[model samples]
Target: MLVDSYGRRIRKLRVSLTDQCNLRCHYCMPINAEFMEVNRYLTPKEYGEIIAELVTLGLEEVRLTGGEPLLRQALPEILTTISRCSLKKISLTTNGILLHRYLELLQQHHILDLNISLDSLKPEIFTQITHGRNLSQIQTNITLAKQQGFRIKINTVMMRGVNDLELFNFVEYAKSENIEIRFLELMRIGQACQQQQDQFIPAQELIDRLKTRYTLQAQAMPLDSTAFNFITECGARIGFIASESQPFCGHCSRWRLSADGILRACLLKTDGLEIRELNHEQRLAAYEQLLGMKPYLRPMEVTHLMHQIGG
Candidate 1:
């Protein structure tokens, strides 16, 4: 087993398929973003090899991420490769814009757990946050995925002046749809760092606000879980990823592999071990090095963007 000095066991791996995304969310990307050359991304075969090795080293779950994973042309092939490994669960994080095109294929690969990013329910607000106009289509896709028996989780980054007023709206949606909605605090990373102060909202504040209307019972989660979850009086589930106010770094058991095959032990750290050019034995050594590099607490700031670090 890959255990760090702090005794945190590495059990999950997050892989970025590409740095390309269709929507230019202000917090995640710049208005005019330039993507890496296609050749710089790790190919499906390379991903399969690395993932197979990581599984042997004690990785039980793999989550595919991206600037937008669905934008990758070879995503189906990548999914097929990952499905061949021995894993307890396989998941993907996407914006839900292209989910309709790959729903059947994802089910075929047994990727039933999905994290969809949706900031707002209103058309204008959604476009303002994401700089895209697919609110209606994404909502339809979420419903379709639910009907198809997929476990869906909605991720919303709560910005104070932006969409903080929609907290109750999201809670009601969660109750009506019987799905989990996770509100994430704005982090000091990349383009988001510039607006973190003006937009940040602490998780405690959100919880206090919810207590006014509903009773929330704390839910038990894995020690390594990032979100602190709760069940509402109405039976709806809600969660908070309060990376800023309530950090979970001591229990973090995951490592990230960027699209370019750089392995990062901490999201806030800018430097990582590049293993794309390493052989099997060398890659194993690199993993060992990374395990020792894991920090016991969250860093004050991260120079890389969430997408660059495979959020």
Candidate 2:
């Protein structure tokens, strides 16, 4: 088992399969974002081997992420390969644009959770935020996934004047649809930093306001989770990722593996341990060195694009 300098046991890994995405959400990046060449990404077999090796080092959970992970054609094969590993759980974080297309594949592989990124419920605002017209498609997919009994979580980025007004809508939707909704603080990362100073709303502020409308009872958090969850009197589960106003660095145990194979020890840090072309033994050695590089605290500022950093 790999433990960091702070004695935080490293157990979860979030891997970005590709940096390509279909949506250009205002908080993520500009519409015409340029990504790395396809050949630069690790092959399906390579990624499988990497996950397998990490599991041998005490990695317990794995999340497949991307600018939009479903954009990768080999994802099913990749998931199939990793499912054979002795990992405790596997999940996917996506924009939900192509989720319906891969429903069967995800179910067949028994992916434990689906963290869908949906910032707005209003069609017009959703279009404005994502710069895409696939709101209907994504909603349809969400509905279908829920009907099929998938463990679904909606991840919403709360940008001040942009989508913060929809907090009630999100809560109502969660209650009506029987889903979990998480509100994430807008990190000052890459293009998101371009947002007006007034646009970044802390998650705690929203939580405080939510307390007025409903009874919020705090729930015990899972070991690898960063969100603080509250179960409402009405049985609605809401969560907050207070990375800005309240940093959870002391208990953070996950590390990110970028599509190009960089081991990110901190989300706000610009540099990370690169593992792109290393052999199996060399990669393990590099991971050992990377453990020591994990800082006890993050700067609470982001210097890289959130999408490229394996959200």
Candidate 3:
């Protein structure tokens, strides 16, 4: 098994296909920063090559993410290539705006698992969270995806009373719809910090709410994960990704590849080696070096938003 300096086996890679997003969520979207210049970003070809190499080094799983992955036209070819390599799993986390249009193409290319980010169940709340995007369209897209028989995971960030009280509503919806829900703890970052409480809710608090009924087991329990993944008594799966309350740094085996090809050593570490800027040999050597960076037990407060860092 390929291991990082922390002794955490590197098995999964989350690749950010693009930095440009169709919607501007209040939390993740930068207020006034210039986006990555199109010419400066890595194209699908270069990304695929890096993924191929990473797979040889123990990449057992790959999740194609983006500001919205469906924005890229070359993604079908990219997914097709990775799926053909027989990776254990290949999934995409999309906003679901463009999913309806690409549903068939996604299945055709062997991309099955999908993790969609949806924070609100109420239409007005959806509008509030997503900044004016039509909730009805997203709802239609999700319903259509379900009918098409996709292995879907809905990722919702718990914001205090905003979406927290409605958690079980989503859980019930998932149960009725035969879908899975992953309630994530809001991390401190970009637009996330603007909330009075930073809108940061701890994972245990959510699980405690769950404990009122279901027997929950924390998967890959790292203290930092505050993101506990659990299965219900009747076999329904509900997960929590506690990135802040409990730091899962020691067992963090995942690495993120940004649109510009930067290898983030830690989710909180913004500066790491950039693959595009390195020669082939130097790139490999630098990758090895990053895998050898000192592991932190007490991690610093994270400043990068998940969208920017491909969380």
C-alpha lDDT values of all predictions: 0.93, 0.87, 0.75
The global Cα lDDT (0 to 1) of model 1 is 0.93
lDDT of 2 by residue, 1-311 (tens): 78986789989898998998998987777788889998888887888888889888999998899989999877877888889998899999988888888989888998849999999999999999998988889889899999988999999988877888899889999988899999998888888787837788887789888987999999998865789899999989999998888888888888898898888777777788878688988998998898877777768567577778778
How do all the candidates rank in terms of lDDT, highest first? 1, 2, 3
lDDT-better candidate, 2 vs 3: 2
Query: Which has the greatest lDDT?
Result: 1
1 or 2: which has the higher lDDT?
1
Candidate 1, superposed: residue stretches over 4 Å from native: none
Task: Compute each candidate's TM-score over C-alphas.
Answer: 0.99, 0.97, 0.89
Worst 10 residues of 2 by lDDT: 295-304
Q: TM-score winner between 1 and 2, please give it.
A: 1
lDDT accuracy of residue 209 in candidate 2: 84
Q: What's the number of clashes in each of the models?
A: 0, 1, 11
Candidate 1, residues 19-115, lDDT tens digits: the string is: 8888988999887888889999999999999999999989999999998999999998999999999999999999999999999999999999999
TM-score of candidate 3 to 2 decimals: 0.89
Residue 236 of model 3 has an lDDT of 67
* Candidate closest to the true structure, highest TM-score: 1
